[model samples]
Target: MYSGQSIAITGAGGGIGRAMAEKFLAQGAKVAISDINTELVEKTAAEIGATAFTCDVASEEAITAFIQGAEAANGPVDVFVSNAGVGFPDEPGGHAAGGSNESWELSWQINVMSSVYASRALIPGWKKRGQEGVKGRFVIVASAAGLLAQVYSGSYTTTKHAAVGFAEYMAIMHKADGIKVHCVCPQYVKTNMTKGMTEIKEGPGKHLEASDVADSLFAAIEKDEFLVLPHPVIKDYFQAKAADPDNYIGGMAYRAKTIDKGHIPLQ
Candidate 1:
C-alpha cells in the first residue's frame, strides 16, 4: 500500500516500530527509521533496508533532526509515524500516586508531546502541500489505555489519553486540508513495553504481535480511518465506556482490585 512513498517512523529500533518499518519496506516504500538507541536503530535499519537515524522523540530538537535527516535520506516524508512512547510499570509513586515529578514529565514528553512536536513541524508543510493536492499522513501509536484506562500506571494512561485527544484534534481540524491522521489503540502486545507486565489477567483477546498491530494500522490508513483498534474488542470496550462512564469506571475498579498487584484503591 505504501509503495513509492517516503515513510518515517520514530522508535523504530524494536517492537511495533520495527515491525512497521519491515512491513513498509516489503510494500516498496522508502523507510526512515529512528530510535533512542543508536545500535538498535542501525541494526533494524540495516535489516529492513531502511534509512537509520538515532533520535529521542522526547526532545523536540532530536525530532526535528530526525525528520530532516529522514527527508534528506529518503524524500519528503509522505507519512510520519509518531510511535515512540515510554512508561514506568513498577514505580512506587506514579502519575497521581506520588511518583517522582521526573517520571511524569518524561511520560508527558515521550507519549504526548512527541506527537505534538511532529504536528508542529509537519502541519504547516502538509497544509501548504495539501492545498496543491498533495496529502500527508500522521499516525500515532497509542494504547487502549488511551480509550479506557490502565490500573497500575497513571502516567501511561493519562499521557495516552492526551495522545488520543491530540490525534483526534489533528484529524478533525485537518481533514479538509488533506492531512490524514490515524491513532492506533491496541490492547496488550508482546512488546518491550509490556515485557514484565503480569497484571494483564484474563482478557478477551490474547496478547498481539507487533506485526499484527502494523497490519491493522496500514489497513486503517488505507481507509482513511481515524482510529485503529488492533484488538477489535477495544472498540466495544470503548463504546461501553462512552455509553456509561460511571458503570465503566466501577467495572474497571473491580478489575483492578481483583487482578492488579499494585493494590490500587478505588477511592
Candidate 2:
C-alpha cells in the first residue's frame, strides 16, 4: 500500500523513527522526515534523499507547520507516522503511583498529544481530498505498556495507553471516509531509552530491533490491520490479561519483585 506514496514521520532522527524512515525509502516512498534534532534529521534526509523538517511534535504550531512544509515539498502526505516519545526511569517514593507531575505532563504532550496534533492538522486535508480509502494510513507507535502497565514508569504507561485509545477512535471515526489507522505495540527494544537496564535480560527473540518493528508496521499498513504488534507475544499477554485482569496484574507484580531482588535502588 505504501509503494511510491508520500509519507511523513515524526521523530525520524533516531531509533525506531530512523529505522522506519529507512525502510519506507527502501520501499520507494517519498518521505518527509521530521525531528527535534535538525542536524540528525537533515543528515538522515540527505542520506536517504528524503525531505527533512525540524519540528518538536509536542508543539501544535510546529506540527502544523511541519504538515504544510511536507505537503509543499512532496504533495499531500499519504501516510503519517506519529512516533516521538520520551522515557522517565522509575524513581523512589512511589514514582509509578503519584510522582513527578512535570514528567507526566511532558509524557502526555509527546506520547499522547503529538498524535492528536498531527491528526488534527492532516485529517482536514484528508477529508477535503476525499482520499481516505485509497491507501491512506495513520500509524501510531504505541508500546506494550499501553496494553499492560510498566512497573516503574507510570507516565509512560498512561500516555501510551492514551495513544492507543486515540488511534482506535480515529480508526472508528474515519473508516467510512477511507482513513486507515494502526497502533504499533512493541516490547523492550535495544535503544538509547533502555540503555542501562541490566535487569532486562535478552531472551530468545525477546528484544526486538527498531527495524524489525518498522517492518512489521509496514506490513500491517498493507494489510490495513489496526493493531501492529511487533512482539507477537504481547498479543497473547494482552489476551491473558483480558481473560483475568487481577491474576495478570498479580503475576506481573511477582515478576517485578523477583527481578529487583538483591539490587540496590538507584541513589
Candidate 3:
C-alpha cells in the first residue's frame, strides 16, 4: 500500500520502530530509520535495507537534521513517524519526590517534546505543499496509557497524555490543509520498552507482538484514521473511562493497589 513512498521513522533501531521500518520496507517504501544508538540504527538499517541515521529526538536541532538528512537520502517524506519514547523509574509520590525530577524531565523531553519537535520540523513544509492540496502523514506512536493511565509511572502517563493531546491538536488544526496526523495508541506491545516487566494475563490488558502493532498502524494509515488503537480493548476501556470518570478512577485505584502491593520500589 505504501509503494514508492518515502518514510522516516524515529527510534527505529528496535521494537515497534524497527517493526514499522520493516513493514514499510516490505510494502516498497523508501525508508530512513534512526535511533539515538548509532550501532543499533546502523544494524537495523543494514538488516532492513533502510537508510540509517543516529538522532537524538529529544533535541530539536537533532530532529531537524534527521528530517533534512532523510529527505536528502530518499525524497520528500510522505510519512514521518515520531515513535521514540522513554519510560522512567516510578516515583512513590509521583512528581513530588526529589529523584522524580530527572525522570520527569527526561520523559517530558523524549515522550512529549519529541513529537512537538517533529511537528515543528514537518508542519511548515507540509503546509506549503498542503496548501496546494498535497498530503503528508505525521504519525505519533503514543501509548494507550495516554488514554487510560500507567499505574506504575507518573512521568510516563503524563507525557503520553500530552503526546496524544498534541497529536489531536495538530489533526484538528491542520486537516483542512491536507496534513494527516495520526496517533497510534497500543497497550502491552512486546518491545524493548516493556523488557523486564511481567506480563499480565488477565485484567484490562494483553500483550501483543510489535509486528501486530505495526500491522494495525498500516491499516490505520490505509483508512486515513486519526486514532489507531492496536489493542481494540483499549477503545472499550477508553469509552468506559470517558463515560464515568469517578468509577474509572475507583477501579484504577484498586488495580494500582493490587499491582503495587507492599508499596515497594517497582523498578
C-alpha lDDT of all candidate models, in order = 0.85, 0.83, 0.86
Write candidate 2's Cα lDDT for 84-124 as tens digits.
88866466556355757887788999999999999998887
lDDT of 1 by residue, 195-225 (tens): 6555344566667889999999988877768
User: Considering lDDT, where higher is better, how would the candidates rank from best to worst?
Assistant: 3, 1, 2
Task: Give the number of the best model, judged by lDDT.
Answer: 3
Give me the runs in candidate 2 sitting further than 4 Å from their true place. 93-95, 130-132, 199-205, 260-267
Q: Kindly state the number of residue pairs that clash in model 2.
A: 2
Q: Which 10 consecutive residues of model 2 have the lowest summed lDDT?
A: 258-267
Looking at model 2, residue 184 earns an lDDT score of: 93
Separately for all candidates shown, the number of backbone clashes (residues 3 or more apart, or on different chains) is 1, 2, 0
lDDT of prediction 3: 0.86
Score residue 53 of candidate 2 by CA lDDT: 96
**By lDDT, is 1 or 2 better?**
1
In model 2, residue pairs whose N, Cα or C atoms come closer than 3 Å (at least 3 residues apart or on different chains), thus clashing, are 132-178, 133-178
